[model samples]
Target: MKVIAFGASTSSSSINKALATYTANLIEGADVQVLDIANYNVPMFSEDTEKEIGQAEGAQAFLRDLSEADAFVISFAEHNGHYPAAYKNLFDWATRIDRSVFGEKPAVYLATSPGPGGAQTVLGAAVGSAPYFGGNVKASVSVPSFYENFDLDTGKVKNEEIASQLKEAVSALN
Candidate 1:
């Protein structure tokens, strides 16, 4: 299966990216594409901007990514209890291209943060929005204090419980 995994953050040193990358690797026999939101940079989503440029390169790229994927794995990085600006912008651009970019494709939604809440609010918001945008909603997980649970060098889960949960989420995707 062709799977596309990405962190919603555009930060170069995003722990969310690490988590998504690690999760993508756990799924066997899948062609995984680890995408960085930075690759698709837009001026920012706005009616004024859209009226001027129609759609930017980034918006088109977002649509292309969805069009090519059989399944999606996204680990959202919360910024103040909500989606990151970069990701939200991408979502805006995607909706402009196709109202339902997800196209009811199965996905493993994830979230992570430095605190114990593990970006739960943002994950919940996305989960609620998923069905509206054609997400199959296969599984979900939240990794709290990602730095504590993941080993950067080995790219393995240090917390056994979280690792097991991650495995179960991935298995559900199949």
Candidate 2:
């Protein structure tokens, strides 16, 4: 199976990205592609911009990449209890190209932060809205106190409980 994974953030040092990559790799025998949204630098989405530029090359490329995936692993980064602007912008533009942006692909949604909230607010939003955008959610996990639960140097989850939960969640994809 081919899995596409990404953190919905543009931070250079995104812990969410690391988590997404680690989680996606848990799928046995699956080819994982990790994407960086920052690389697809499309202008912010707006009706005016859409009218002026039509579909953006960046959005087109993003969609093309997603079209190849059999499943997805996405870690959302919360900005004021919502998606980060850069990710939302890319998603908005992609939606303009295709409203059903996820293309009915199964997805494992995840979220994490250094604090205990685990970015769950945004993760909940993503899960709640996923179906309308063609996402088939397999499972969702929220890892809180990221530094305490995960080992960045090794790119692994140190907390056994969270690791087990993540393993269980990934298993749903199969």
Q: Report model 1's TM-score to 2 decimal places.
A: 0.97
Taking the tens digit of each residue's C-alpha lDDT, what string does model 1 give over 108-148? 99999999999999999999999888888799999998889
- In model 2, which range of ten residues has the least summed lDDT? 37-46
> Each candidate: RMSD to true structure?
0.9, 0.6
Residue 21, candidate 1: alpha-carbon lDDT: 88
Cα shift from native, residue 60, model 1 (Å): 0.7
| Candidate lDDT values, in order | 0.90, 0.95
Q: Point to the candidate with the largest lDDT.
A: 2
Supply the TM-score for candidate 2.
0.99
